[model samples]
Target: MGTCKCHLKLRKPEDAAAACSKVLELDGENMEALKNRAEAHILAERFEQAKQDAHKAHEKDQNDRSVMEMLQRIDRLIKMASRKDYYKVLGVDKLTATARDIKKAYKKLAVQWHPDKNQDNLEEADKMFKEIAEAHDVLGDEEKRGKYDRGEDLNEQPQGHPDPHTMFFQNGGFPGGGGQRFFFRQG
Candidate 1:
């Protein structure tokens, strides 16, 4: 038995990782700590460490989905790391595509590989969708697209962002500074 440290519940990856590491310092074979730390390692992009930690946790508990997902993400990220160029991800040539052209290309590819349209190959479709989403997301935003063009880090937000309010407020501004004042009728 080791010294019991502070018992704190972590809701985020960094905190979880710290707690897990502290626990592991006390007990190396702690499965829960290993899994939590592995997840944090993945979030932190420490793929090799994540893979090792996930493997250890998985060996202890084979039914852990978090461990399995982390392993799969690490494998995919390793593959993607080989093809870091955004143009390659979108299957497009450099300087030949405008933003609209990229959108059209993404739409075409998305429709072709949409999971609903390809029921027999959902996994493949999902992978294609993710690629398309990533490509479109980068190429659609000016800042991200420019970074991507320069081969800089462009893992930013994506495209087709819809308004959450559904155009409730027009360009001319709202009725009474924001909303309308309604008088309730006495029953």
Candidate 2:
């Protein structure tokens, strides 16, 4: 006899793998055991092995929804792992992030994206810099800054910043007339 799937659900990957192996020994074609083990591997982020196990489960039961779901999940995880976050790129955390820290992170990131430093790549650096700038801007404002620290939604537009098109227009730009005026041409 081997452990049921539920018994191994919350266990560590290694433990789940052991239980799954036992289940497989009892019945080599146990799709449930294979799927559970694949899930465990996903939690552990052993993606390649997880992909293999998920593929095997799909093979065993071609029409199984669980297998298809697991494969889609694995694809998403693999993609997420490939794209790094700005915090990781800067090597800092929100708790300790001061203006100085922001400057330092920017400098380091600039170096990484610098045309001289990365002769073969340029676009990635710009995208990284934009993210860094946005993070700094939100964290720097006092009300927005405090909200961010409290894990509130800082992305919400600030209260006083007027809608540009509705409130003001000058030379088709903004903030000044700049020798041009904008008004509805009403007859």
Candidate 3:
């Protein structure tokens, strides 16, 4: 246990996990070992393993603040993973994408999915358009892209951040600022 703590304090999470694993082998119900292992997994970007250790720690000590925090972090990681991937939505390859690549992909997808162009499948097109717009809005901005890359929560729009829908209109997605009220069927 002390060895685990020492490794964690030295910022060696893999070593800490190994130490915690050793302790768990001797005492499987050790709360400290579970909590430490969970945190180490989190730092290692193994969210699934972190989730398991966090749940086990929570089960052993429901009132532990560290355990609760681990659970919360695990939840955030899970939610972030499940959210729409902006790169996939924009059709840009994340590994070799430049800003120009992102913009070109967004333009192509937006035109392809525009509601006016897909009148036969208006609802689906509108949904696709919105997704494309949001993907562009995030991936286009460096600050937002950095945060997104770090896997931070971006559910709330910060003050002054442009709305993806309005941004599409401002970029002349619709001729003469027309289509928002008529083209998309509000459900």
Best by TM-score: 3
Candidate 1 local accuracy as lDDT? 0.71
Q: Residue-wise lDDT of candidate 2 within 21-78, one digit each (tens)?
A: 7888888898888888887788788988889989999998899997998898798788
lDDT of 1 by residue, 113-146 (tens): 8999999999999998888898788888988777
Worst 10 residues of 3 by lDDT: 174-183
Candidate 1 at 18: error in angstroms?
A: 3.1
- Pitting candidate 2 against candidate 3, the one with the higher TM-score is 3
Worst 10 residues of 1 by lDDT: 1-10
lDDT value, residue 152 of candidate 2: 47
lDDT of 2: 0.71
Off by over 4 Å in 1: 1-16, 87-187
Candidate 3, residue 170: lDDT? 97
Angstrom error of the Cα, residue 97, model 1: value is 14
- What overall lDDT goes with each candidate model? 0.71, 0.71, 0.88
